[model samples]
Target chain A: MTAIGKVSLRDTVFQRGRSKERSKLLVFNHTVLLLLTAFAVIPLAVLLFNSLKTELDIGQNPLGPPRTIVIENFREAWEEGDFAITMRNSVIYVVATITAELVLGGLAAYALARKRPPGSDLLMLYFLVASTIPVWMYIVPLFVQMRMMKMLGTFHGLIIIYIAGNAPLTIFLLRSYMIDLPSELEDAARVDGANEFQVLTRIVLPLTKPGFLTVGLVVGLGVWNEYTLALTFIHDPNRFPVTTSFAKFVDRFDTNWALTSAGAIIILFPVMVLFLALQRQFIEGLAEGGIKT
Target chain B: MAVLTQQKPTTVIEKLSDEIWRKKFLRNVIIPWVFIAPLLIIHIFVVAIPAVQGVYMSMTDWGGINPNVNFIGLDNYHELLFEDKSFGKSLNNNIVWMLFFLTVPFILALFCASMLAQIKRGGMLYRSILFIPYVLASVVTTTIWKNLLNPKDGIVAASARALGIEGFEVAFLGRTDTALMSIAFIDNWHFWGFLMILFLAAMQAIPPVLYDAAKIDGANRWQEFRHVTLPGIRPIVLFMFMMVAIWSFLAFDYIWLITQGGPGGASEVIATQLYKNAFQRFEAGYAAAQGVVISIFAGFIIMIFVMLRRRGWDI
Candidate 1:
């Protein structure tokens, strides 16, 4: 009893000493993390602050908080940047690309998973090689080819490109998701005389709603933020999506910090809202899709 | 298909015959291909055919405009390698970039991830905040930083003036010496946080008992981390290393957005070079060669990792 009490007392004493050391480490750890968090966040705060500042204020105080909020900058930016047309354009691209990509990719993923179609391995091999081919490798010929087909500088052209570009990723993610589903329900549906398409839509699709959602979100976000393809194929400003249009706007308004800042904020608002609402999925999906720029 | 399958008799012989038909030409071949054809056709037209055309075009003197393209085998590759000093410089810059990305983000992420992993409370807040930059578009990120780094009316000069620090108001993205590094720094700001979140996730997956055992062994935090945490996350760390290395070659958008590989070709990477060649300079053949070179580097990295795996490395 005496020995056990002695050991307990020693452990408590050691823990007490460790607490002092740990307290110091905790401060150090948090200070470093706090600094990094600021590094990531402060510039964004500055953009928001500058967006509300006048040119006079921005010229005088580059990154300081606004003395008075200038919500008019958003209005000004909206008009001048042509964000009305551009945002609508971006929505079209996002909606069409996501819908087409999900439908096509979902069907392919379904075939790869359930159907185990003949030559599935060959298809997998093709995508594995295709995914590794840099866009630069194909951009020139693709441009020439698009022009040949009269698909360049058109919305359908851009949408077709986006749908194809996104297929490999969508197939890879959704196929893995579909593969894990139990075969019993599918077997029962088949036994009950469900056709292949019916089995897919009724039993498989509903069961894999989360998979579809993930593919939709990933493809939607990619199409929305896409720059290089849009920059290349959609040369007409009338058809410019928000990103390419915003880039041009920022360049033209180089000195108009308030306007450009407002533009940046407007471009990011939808993404921010969606991200906060779906933080987990966004993080996980991006982590998995880290190969993308 | 299912209707035909459903009409089968219960006899094993009948069921066997039906299963054979279903597994063969009907179920396995025709029906599956019907479902797969749409996506396959799209991919073939958009990616495969163009890619094959690109390879063939790379060996020619195609200026991207004229219908006449002359085949000149190995000339584009020869010129890119021997005559293009800018290619070498850009290649050097890419190397510097790969080095920067492979180290800076890894360190920052490891440090921040380790620190965040220690704190249970408010960890989510810090992570979410750190990850915000990653979610922002490249245009927005570049725009935000360009203004911040602008010489006369930017945060750098303004803050320096506020603090009475003189002679630090140089143009970061304008000067040749600073341009590539500046773009890299901006890209890292948007990138490291994502790395932090990823590393933190891997760290979280590490068994707590490992830490407990390390503590019982009188191992300090550094020792514990070096011995346990590093090994625990080796696969993810190495995988990210390979990914960052591959991505460094393809680094574009930010550099293109900010500088367009200019202010005297200071920040020209392969992709930017390829873009300018195809669109601006109309050197389609040369640009295709550059693309092939970039892919070769990326493929080489993949090959190394694959070979390492073949050699029984856990990664």
Candidate 2:
């Protein structure tokens, strides 16, 4: 790497005199990138700053850094926003959806990728068409159906919807991954007196762990950040997820910027940490997921 | 061989092949379906059946409760198309939203992606930073922007005061004139970065040798981009265009969370109208019609793209 770097450096040095325009363009690139970065980040910085400020401080220094750091806004927002309940509810929705989606999606993907059963292609086509259908198309009838089944305002009900809503993406992504895996290991495992289930559990599962992780992250993020279905199906405040609950909190305290900022931070904190920690997975998975509701 | 009692075979080889076929049938067909059944059943019930029911319900006066028993055919659609003024306004707003999204984000993302592609150093860092907003929940994004656009104490007010500019601190989300566009701008802010990252990925995949060739041929940066980069990224660009056009019609969270289609129905879109009609007005049939309308619009966009593809557009 160092040798390659040295060679590139020497090449740049040799080309520097003739390619002054290149350096000028680099400056222009950095300037525009910096401005775009600021455009993306400054509002978030202000939110963080306002979260630390008091109402009085925000009144005076609204978009600037806080004059005094008041840690109590988080405490106040936490209690007032009922974040304890909402956060737990969101986690339950996310975790349950991921678990169910992985198990069911994994099974389905494995069958599609390896077994190649009759009509599997038809099923794949079904999911592809189903995925393109907007949620608005079915949300009203689904709400009535959920109500008829007495599943409204319930965590399991919401989880079931999330699992189903994410089924297409999950199956598509996991099947693509499983399709790339060599089948020799499974054939060898079959020779070792392993059943199909055993081959999947022991061989395919471990080999395709990264696929599961990617699907898990994408589905999990979708459930965590979901708003429309949560708002539609969950009328009970106590059962509300973080997204819906935060919207309600903002509604009640639209003018209280400090408290709202702190509330926003509370909701954002976990997502941000996870994003920064596993940005590559997050970015690639979401990009692959594409236009999720 | 002795347990091959399920089907009678006249010959030994016939029995042998029969046994193998049964085994393959069990292992391949039944088991796979079993594995797929749980999720597939649930998805079919949740999405498929309801979607089909939604089509039927749009023709009925279901009223969202009491299990009403009337099937009035196409009346709701008639009302939506001819009678409902708000639906027309909302559909118009959605078109405006679609137009803005198709143009602004594509141009912004393409320009920035090309610029970022030129840089070798800190490209990853810049990409990550820009993408941070996309990872954020819509709730959090709207909250941040809502405060920043607060006419009373927002950055606009503060900066305008500092610069001695008059009449600059307008309520962006308050007035009917600006509410829809302001919300679109905020949504775009959280959104365009994702598009930039996507375009950047596509740009990176164009093979550096193409750029080298372009440079060797005395091509300027813009010329190289126009010819090499754009053509290389055409498929993804076109695919995203269709997806964005579909999503623009389905856009709900940003507008709902920010304005709730308020300030005199300024930012209302089809989905928002559908939501209110179903939940608030208890007009399930009407809303289902709206939902179908939205789907028709999306399907229409998709069909156009399909037609383009069939015409050898290379999309």
Candidate 3:
């Protein structure tokens, strides 16, 4: 009886010790995570704070809370910097490029996924090779072509260039997703007397909405943020995209930190909202398409 | 008898003709062509034309603005390779940038991913916060860092002063020696978050049973990590490594905005050099040649990646 009681007592002590160790570990983990979170959040918070303060306040008390939030910085930035035009240009460019990329990219992807055409595999390989090629090499030549065609400084030209540059990867990603779709569904559509066009539009397109959304979001973000091509091709200020316009703002020696930061924040808001709204689909798409190759 | 035979023969020929008409050629070929034509036109006009033009431009002596250009065979390539001192410096900087940027972030990300994988609570929050920097425009990122790293009245300098390091200010971005490293550090800051999330996702996809088995075999944390986590994430690590290598070679925005290839061209990467030659100097031909060199280097690295990929590193 005494031996049995002693054994139980020992077991209880050991269990307590293990529980204490586990709690310690949990605390340690939480502390580390909090620290990391602070590190990540601090710089952005500082930027926001600076954006709200006048430049003098920023120079004086960099880390301190703003004495008075200057709400007029955004208004000033919009008017003086012509950010409204820049924003419009960004929207137009992103929308046009994404639409063309999706339609064209989707068609190519469907062909590769469904048709199994002769040399389709070779075409796919060519795309992979093309996607990895350094785009800077093509920039000068593209510039020359745009000049020759009298398309430089035109929105239509920018759209064409953006679509062409982005189509290879977009097609690659869309194709992968389309290929994963079950063949049985397509076969059933054919059995129902649906021709290839009907199958593509009615059946495949509906099912691949997620893939389209993913491609659209990624490509849109890239086109919106692109600077080099825009800077090179769009010599006219009126035709400048948001990125090139922002770069011009920098070059003008305009050190209005509040306005600059406000503009940055404003530019980022849409992308942030889009990401938050479609976080799941965006992440899944990136995981599947980006990591696969 | 003759009328009955002629009517039967005509009916047979009409039936065969109807069957042939049903195999619609337009449906098979034209429809798909209609769908594909837009992308094909854009690709041929924008991408292919320019790419070919870039090659031709390399062999000529063309100032970008001038309509007239002299065909000077191999002169631009010869100058870039032999005469240009800055080109060599840019090449060296690119190499260093690739090494530091690829290895440091990769290791840090792996560690962070492993730790995050062990935790269950607040995982999504951690991931979102980490990925915030990557979504910011490069211009914004560079602007913020420029202020942060300023020699006078910058937050970092002020903090150092507060910590009793009197007059301990470093013009990191302005100095030739430290400029490249500073730019690299900023690049890592903006990038590490995205990589961490990627690695975390990869880590989470690894099965828990592997760790359970390792523990059952009397393995400790380090041993379990080696036996389970390392092997599980090897492919992801290799893939990310190659991506970092490629991206580092292509690094431009931060270097361009922050340094502008300044402090005696210490931070002049290949991309920036290419830009300067093409745009600022109006040496379109020379820039094209430099571009070809850049492509060759990029192609070499890509080939290595492809070979490794083909060897079943990942499919």
The per-model lDDT (C-alpha) reads: 0.88, 0.90, 0.78
Model 3 Cα lDDT, one tens digit per residue, A216-268: 97788778778777877888878787787877775563466677777767777
User: For every candidate structure, what is the RMSD over all alpha carbons to the true structure, in angstroms?
Assistant: 4.8, 2.5, 6.2
Clashing pairs in 1: none
Task: Kindly indicate the candidate among 1 and 2 with the higher DockQ.
Answer: 2
Task: Arrange candidates, best lDDT first.
Answer: 2, 1, 3
**Which residue pairs show collisions in model 2?**
none
Q: How many collisions between residues are there in candidate 1?
A: 0
Sequence-dependent TM-score of model 2: 0.96
Off by over 4 Å in 1: A1-17, A291-293, B1-24
lDDT at position B114, candidate 3: 72
Quote the lDDT for B162 in model 1: 84
Q: Sort every candidate by DockQ, greatest first.
A: 2, 1, 3
Q: What TM value does chain A in model 1 reach?
A: 0.92
Give the number of the best model, judged by lDDT. 2
Looking at candidate 2, what is the lDDT of residue B46? 93
Candidate 1 vs candidate 3, TM-score winner? 1
TM-score of chain A considered alone, across all candidate predictions = 0.92, 0.95, 0.88
TM-score, per-candidate, Cα-based = 0.93, 0.96, 0.91
TM-score of chain B of each: 0.92, 0.96, 0.90
